[model samples]
Target: MKFRSLLIVAVALVAWTNVPAKSASGVPTYIASAVTDSARPPDDKAQDAKRKPDEVLAFAGIKPGDKVVDLMPGSGYYSRIFGKIVGTTGTVYALQPTEMDKAAPKGLQSLKTFAGTPAYPNVTVLVQSAAAIAIPEQVDMVWTSQNYHDLHDPFMGSPDMARFNRSIFDALKPGGIFLVLDHAAAEGSGLSRTDDLHRIDPAAVKAEITAAGFEFVGESKVLRNAEDKHSLSIYDPSIKGKTDKFIYKFRKPLS
Candidate 1:
């Protein structure tokens, strides 16, 4: 009887123990550091509540001195954050689709001007075709936030996903991370919602990246919303700032 009681207690103890607060808690140190850094633009800091940059970057496993490529850096939100986190010894490629200049000239110019600033000397502006991403050299991490769904849109010109994923696979050093975070679509929605709702099925993303030889390390639920119905555009006024999102971490296999 005593042994049975002890066994139950042991099981309960194991179940009750939580992941370290730093690992799965409120905010990661790297994120907090970057978010609070005076170098971050005031406007980018304004979006912190909605974007949760710290938690997202923490879950992505970014670290000091790691080289990064901020895929589709848009207005250079994460690019700027990464530039701060990676510091002087690190490098950040603030990448944008070449078409950005045609579609959103201001955004392209914003990225260029930010990269040229003396404040973030480690950052470099990289304009390229998203369909054929060219990152110049291997990097420690590639971060694509909120733009993975657009890679499937026809307007992006039917991206050769096979080639795109392969390029990502080749760009990362062995065991380097590929962090993808985007608004979520309803379960089983597949790619249908990508163009219409600006969302993607997390499962589809996992399958595609795994096929490209990346190991699915894990996901973080910090951005999840139980109330989210996963319908409507991510920009819908009601759901814009509070949309359900998923963050997936993939790693290249070490040879």
Candidate 2:
């Protein structure tokens, strides 16, 4: 009887080891609810298929009562969803670069107005120079989507990136998360395409963030497109919504 039991246990262990990992399509209930919140604009909902907010949010691990910074929030697309997910107790700071507004004020008007409405009372808009990121308080997470490349462009004042990254590292509580999602450039392109193509090499991002004392936790392939040639302008008609993208998650060390 003892010999038979040992054989059954070994068989179960092997079976478990053979099971496949969970698919990226899985979405947590709270994250799904946040994505589907009725208060989100119809246009925002229309972009859901391309943005993959549910999976992205789940990867961020945002929760109620956590403070989040939507760094360089262009139109509050993610900020709105973040607000709902964080609920009343949490806060979402829609941090915008002052230089971006100077370049085009009209683009930011909608998000500015949204921050005032009672619909997202927890969402606050903070406009400051890109050179100095002033996050009022230490936050649980800091997120920037499709705009990290802009920091390397002149329109954003081309701030000192090393200092900028260190500031972010300082703003987070120990072990806090920092999530960056952006268009991907060719493997060895470095920052060459950031201006014209609005894409960046993933390796460069990893190097810069790690230099700031954050650990590269993991990445999600939900937004990656194997078909992307990594050579076109992200705004090109053919690749506007279909461009290859990278989402990197990093964590500040817990001392």
Candidate 3:
């Protein structure tokens, strides 16, 4: 009977090994593990309350074994998180725009150096022109957090957004997701504040992306700050990390 019990335990261990990151509800269990991973910097973890990583990941519907492209992965904050969530069998492309790198060379180097370590074995550093963003291959999800507004800036090579969005649409597998999160601006502010205030009108962003043939899937209010009047710079000492924000999810249709 002891051997039989041992055999049963052994069989369970083997089954758990095969499904290393799954929960019974079909949810990818790795997300919770990734949130509390030791590899995450203390600074990144400190922002968890405001950034809401778990809710963000759930809203994006990320799963284990999914390839993800993290656009303008500034400082590799989400890249490391995604690398952990995707697990060993999955891959993450931490895209660093060459223009942004030129603005801060050491930051880029840090991303390269850290991502190269064993801690993030599944991450690949993708360096490319900001105006010509591309993923090496079709991915399950392409996510940009707090940096989509930069696509409108002239310093980032004055990307032709219409063309750029089209390329993003083409970079995903059918039914794949494109997630964007950014600071919120006044409804009619349009592209006016991007260069200075570092905020954007959520409607304009949705219209621009949907025009590229992506279907608007959903949005999240998890990060919205009602106290924000949408008139101040996102960097203002008063708001900075507490600024009102918007999160949107768009999908490439299967048909």
**How well does candidate 1 match the true structure in TM-score terms?**
0.87
Whole-model Cα lDDT of every candidate shown, in order: 0.86, 0.90, 0.88
Candidate 3 or 2, higher TM-score? 2
Write out the backbone clash pairs for model 1: none
State every prediction's TM-score relative to the real structure. 0.87, 0.89, 0.88
Clash pairs, candidate 2, are none
Point out the worst 10-residue segment of candidate 2 by lDDT.
19-28
lDDT of 1 by residue, 1-255 (tens): 999999999998888773323434566556677778897778888999888888778778787789999988888888888988888889999888876556667777888776857888889988888777888889999999889988898777768887899899999999999999899999998888988898999999998889989999999998998888997798899898898989999999999
Error of 3 at 223 (Å): 0.2
- Write candidate 2's Cα lDDT for 1-255 as tens digits: 999999999999999986534434566566788888898989999999998998888888887788999998888899999898888999999998899888877647878778857989999989889888889999999999999999999888899999999999999999999999999999998998999999999999999999989999999999999999998999899999999999999999999
Which portions of model 2 show Cα errors greater than 4 Å? 1-25
Whole-model alpha-carbon lDDT for candidate 1 = 0.86
